[model samples]
Target: MKNILIFGAGSIGNHMTYASIKLGHKVYITDKNFAALERMKKKIYPKRYGKWNKNINQISNSNLNKLNIFFDLIIIGTPPKTHIELLNKCKKMFKYDKILIEKPLCSYLENYNKLENEKNLFCGYNHSVSQSFQKFLYLIEKEKKQKKIFISIKWQESFKGILGAHFWLKDEYDTYLGDISKGGGAIHEHSHGLHLAIYILKKLKIKNFDFNSNIFFKDMENKPTYDVASVLRFSNSKINLVLETDLLEDNPQKKIIFFNSKTKIIWHNSFTKNLDCIDYQNKKFKKKYNFKKNRSSEFEKEIYHILNIKNQNQYNNSPLNIKYSIEVMKKISRTLKNAKHF
Candidate 1:
């Protein structure tokens, strides 16, 4: 069993802890909030899996505590703002072999540069590890060998809160959707799709592409956020991404379309466990893939794959991939400014 340290007890942190425990890994959870930690401990006990009960521990925020713990992996689920500080702290305490951090690695590019020399640091860009998306990548790669391609994604969702507004939640709330800086707008909300697209294109060795987005709204802070429609242009391909978020749709639907000289493939999801794919050509062919039902379990599998406890058919360089994402974010930032009237 691998020893893992999770440095946050928020929603994502709790999910990470639950997932790690389910995978037969020992997890130590630490958070500055004593009340949140207490609640997590209680919630964690009942959710423990069989013999894994003995492997979980909750560490409070006390400096008197010894700093000699050795962990195989460290998963940082804290807010984006705290990533740099947490990474610096981890670098000082333990020489961890692998670290998994959440998306947008840091709010600023300079913060991420601090760990440039560190090896085996994995950013938790969850879409990179998603089985459904991986399958989609496989299909796209296979098709790229034949003809030119074009893709479009139109995704819409309501009540955009961080981890709280997912379909599993029965109530609707609007805490995060409006906040531009904190929520990072629709671009960040829908960034996984863009990253997945870039990953597929990079794998196919397709270069010379153009991407831009148009923004819409801002929160009370006037942070100049967006509800955007981004367009991407490649030598032999073109893609249009439309995002209708928080303020618009009541029931969200995510649809992705791939078009080529001979065929058109569409993948869509709306309150479903599996995504639906349709191929339209001389005739119509329909297929579906199960996207792994549980979000927490999927994340755990990703962590295992990152730690090499589980084998994944991995390819491409993570740093380069993250750089591509950063570029995309930069473009979004510019686009948000350019489209201020909309």
Candidate 2:
């Protein structure tokens, strides 16, 4: 059981804390917002596992100077703007081996470069860690061997305020969208798509591609942050990604549709949290593929994979995943600039 320290009390932070305690680990959570910390404490104490324990500590910019405890892992879960400051503080307080951060790693290219120089640090893009997405990739790989492919994603945001801001805000929203200086907009949010695209292209050895995005959100500082649509063109493939993040929409729909020249395929969440894949061939024969749900039972599996807890499958390269994430960020930066002008 590792001692983990989490630095934010947001939704992802809460989930990470829950997952860690469920694995029988000791967790220490600190948040500058006392109210958020209190709410988290109340929500967590009643649901904790028998072997698990947690301590909620209040921290602030001034009080942070006194914190000296060395934890097995330090998770930075704060917003994008706070990343660099927190990273610098962590570098001074703990060894590089102890840090793990969330998506878009550092908020800016300069900060990312600074963090890359640190030794023994492990930063990951958590979306790729999802069992559902991994299974999706596996299936895509199998399909690629058989025929040419095309992909389409319609990410409906009827529930716009929930997970939407957490992931998509950096990409489509105004406050962060076009502002490369501050890490705003779709590339930040939709970067997972970019990463997945690049991963598939590399695997399939596809060379040529084109990307286009239409931005409909402006004045993001005082308004809702969301995007209209973005499109991608690859060798023998074209992907249309529609993001409906407007606050005016009452009922939001989120779905991903993929098509080969011959058949249409739909991948979605199942009733049991597993992934459901349906294949339709010219409205004639339909087949369904239900992927086994490993995320729930295998929460520790990915962590163990990352930590090398046992003899696990080693990735072909040590930092390939991190490099892929950085590449996606670069693509996102380019996409954001184009979207801002349009």
Candidate 3:
């Protein structure tokens, strides 16, 4: 079993810790503040996963040096802004086989440069690596051979859902979720839409394409100061994409659809709490593909995938590879800069 060190005890950190332990690995979770660690043990973790394992270690950042133990894998599950900072911190002190940074990798362009082509690094764009997505991709490959495709990715969901998940947050301002500059906004927060689009292009080996983007900003006395919605489009001859992510929808719509002259194909996440679905439609027939899995299963599969990585070739194929997420970051940079205010 691997020894995993997770930095940050927030929602994502708790998910990672639960994943690690469920996979029969030893886990150590730390945060900059002790209260965050306490929250994880006392409330966040036990509440989410039913019960916390006492074996999982909790170490504050100030006390991290006391660990002195080398880990097999390190996962940085902190906020988007602190990802790179904590990554650099981990490298200085820990000996590890791999490091996985949570999605949106970091907030700015400069944060990405330090990680360019880093062989041992990965990100947490977990959806693309999901079994449901794998099945969707397989169907896509078969369908694409017969016709060119058009893609639409929608990750529009209510901001209330995000806040509710954290439960402890008074509002978006309570965390980084309120500010775009800190990497919390419609585009960055819902970047799974962005990454899946990029992943499809990469998998199809699309080299060059034109991209245009527009974002709608939230108006709340200019307090939160972030984009509330985004629409991004990209295309070449064989394929086209229209992607949208927003925080304004009470009726959440999370799906990626690939369509052509005859067929309308879709992949849906959390269509219900425990199911992922794919739909296929044409003039004569319609079909549904369903996967039943718990919320933590994807995160667990992600850690399992990482632990089993034995070489560069396999790692490069990972959906969580930093390279794939780098493409996501570039797209996000362009999307946010092309913003419009409501």
Candidate 4:
């Protein structure tokens, strides 16, 4: 089993710990907050966490304690602001090869370039590793006739659902999810859609593009920015992409649509899971891909693939590495700067 060290006890960190343990990895989780760590330990110790209970350890933060242990893989799952600092700390203690950072790599686009330790660092864009998205890529790569492609993603959910479920710290509310300057809100928070589009464009080797974006906010108290509707547009000779992310829609829809003159492909769930695919051509074709365990399995496969990489050097140059994530963040910064506000 690979030695995996995780440095946060938040929602994403907990999820990563669970996924790593399920894959039979020796996971060492550390958090500055003892309460959060205790909660996670209690939550994962039952039959639900499986036989790997002996393999997981929670390290408490102390003045004299230091993480001087070597790990096969290290995950920087902390907040955006704390990433660089943590990376520097990890660098001093470990000679690790593979490191994975949680999404929105850092708080600002400018901070991303300051990351000196990019050796085998990978960003967490788990959607790209998804089986359903892989199938979508298969079909997309095979097509030769489509001259123009259009991609549009609509991601919507309530404030409580996002804040409470993802960003609510144990006793506090509105940690980062409510802060736009801290890389929160619709534009950066729901940026998986933008990254996914960039991933597709880069994979297809279509480079030239025109882009535009808009940010919006409505009826928010103590928040300096809008959370209503944020729009993104990227177009080229081969593809025209339009993505929308917001926190206002009641039904919560996350879907992507690709269109040309005669063909249209629809993939539902741009964030959670890809469950539906509707292909419309001469006739309408429909296919549904189901995952028994859904999101967990996606994370499992992604973590497993990262674990099995034989050459860390070669793997660092992968498409899903931090380089692409930086590109995505750069575009996002530019988009917000040029966006139209309503």
Candidate 5:
């Protein structure tokens, strides 16, 4: 079994852990706070995965607890503010085959590029590598001959779901998510919508564009100030886009659409907790595709996508490639700078 090391013991950390073990890796997970690791064993993990996994090793992260094992993979599943710091520490630890940093690599985009050229590095925008999106890509290639006029994406969810899963957090203010400068804001947290929209744009060969946003901020005095809602408008010679992300919606909505007056295509998430759907429509008829599985399976598919990398060229070209991630971050950074706030 290949050795896998994961940082952090929070919600994403727990998901990655379950996925790695299911894939039969020798998984070792760590957190800076020992209590967090304790919760993973006693509270967080079993509550989600049904039982504590005996095969998984839980360790406390510290200079005194240095790991001597060489890992095949390392995942930085910590907050955006700590990704760069933890990544550097991973480099100094026993050697690893590759490293995957979770989404929004870091806030303010500071030093975001320092390791972008690292050939073995990747960013986890898991949706980018999903089966539903792959099917969409295939259908899109078949759709190239059709005139494309408009496309829009939405990823709106109440942070209650986040706090509910990670019940330890009292509220948004409990984590970096409440602070825009630290990268937990709506646009950054929900950028999967942005990433997918842009990924399809590249597939369509749209290079030049116009972009702007209407951002709404939560500015409680002495509390973390963040963008709670955002609506982005982008256009090019071939397509126009209206992408929305927000933390205020009671009904969680996540979907992407591509359309002309006569035809439309949509990819929707969470139609049910275990299902993702895609719809294709024309004047004549409509077609639907559904992919259903437990939440753990999403990360399992993502892990397989990472393990299947055959070479450097493949790594660089993979949907998880850092270049594409940085491009998305740049757009987010730009939108935050230019957006008019409410």
Candidate 6:
């Protein structure tokens, strides 16, 4: 059992704490809002995660400056805007071999170069570790080359659902969800499609690429963060990639398609954990592949993998590691800059 310290007790933070404790590890969580910590304690600690013998403690942000404790791993689960600042704080206060930061890593690239090359640092791109996605990779390896790839994602869900699921999202306007500067948007939040596309290309050993995007923001009160349809295009000498993201769709959908001139493969994965794939050629061949439910399994497996890392070089080369995320973030930055806005 490892002693873990988690900064930020928001949605992702709470989940990480629960995962750590469920795996029989002690967790010390820190948050600026004491009320949020108390809510997590009541909501998570005693019902679904109570029976574990491991201890769970909440440390206020003010007290973090005074506490001196060594943790096996430190997870930065705050918003994208706060990651770098909190990370700098943890570096001073803790001695840890591994650090995991929640997705999007950081909101901006201004200070990205200042970050150290820490081999023990990993980002939470859990989709890269999903069994279904791995199987998709394995299946696609049989093809000599992919001529084109297309992905469409619709991440529409109710505000009430968000509030119910993540208690910290009660005040939608105050939370990071309503602020574009803090990495709020369909592209930033539902970025599994973007990362997975990059992951697939990297896994297939295709590197030369260029990205183009057309994005639009929702005209709402307070701040107008983009929630409407957006088109992201990626191209290289070998392939043409097209991906679309939308948070305003009435019926949500998530899918990916890989095709050459003659053959095409489609993977349908939305709310359902089923990875239903159909491979076909117009009149010659058609095949259907079905995978079982393995959503929660990815998080469990990712935790196991992070804890077992012993080499810095290995982490640097990991798909879910900071190096790749930095590269992906750079591409995203480019896409945003060149986006065609309405």
What TM-score would every model get versus the actual structure? Answer: 0.78, 0.70, 0.95, 0.86, 0.95, 0.85
Clash number by candidate, in order: 0, 10, 0, 2, 0, 0
lDDT of each: 0.59, 0.54, 0.85, 0.69, 0.83, 0.69
| The candidate that achieves the highest lDDT relative to the unseen native structure | 3
- Please list the Cα RMSD from the true structure of every candidate, rounded to 1 decimal place: 4.7, 5.6, 1.9, 3.5, 1.9, 3.3
Off by over 4 Å in 6: 44-54, 65-67, 144-164, 167-171, 270-296, 340-342
Q: lDDT tens string, model 5, 131-238?
A: 888887777666666665787788999897767887988889889888887888898888888887777877877778888778888889889798888888878666
Model 6 agreement with the true structure over 260-302: per-residue lDDT tens digits: 6666666666336344344434348777766665434556667
For model 4, the local distance difference test gives: 0.69
Question: What C-alpha lDDT, on a 0 to 100 scale, does residue 287 get in candidate 4?
Answer: 53
lDDT of 1 by residue, 1-342 (tens): 988998887667877887887788888888887886775565543453222355568788784146477788898887665776787788888757777777656553233544545556666777566655556666766776654566766555545433332333343223333344553455655665556566666777777755554455543353444453344333444433333333344456666677777666665543364333443342355555545346666677677667763222232355223465455455555555666632
lDDT of 2 at 293: 53
- Clashing pairs for predicted structure model 1, backbone only: none
Q: Quote the positional error of residue 12 for candidate 2 in Å.
A: 1.4
Better lDDT candidate (3, 6):
3
In model 4, the runs with Cα more than 4 Å from the true position are 43-54, 63-65, 115-117, 164-173, 218-226, 270-288, 312-317, 339-342
Residue runs of model 2 more than 4 Å from their true location after superposition: 43-70, 96-98, 106-124, 145-147, 158-187, 220-229, 232-255, 261-265, 270-287, 291-305, 309-320, 340-342
For candidate 1, give the lDDT of residue 249.
47
Q: Write the per-residue lDDT of candidate 2 for residues 1-342, one digit (tens) a residue.
A: 777777887655666676666576667777777776665566534443332243534465457657666676777777666776887788777643456666665544443544444443444555455555556655666656545566654433332543353442343333444443554444454444555566656665566666554445445566644443455444444443333222233354334456666566665534244544444344567666665653333445444445552222244333324556566666655655776642
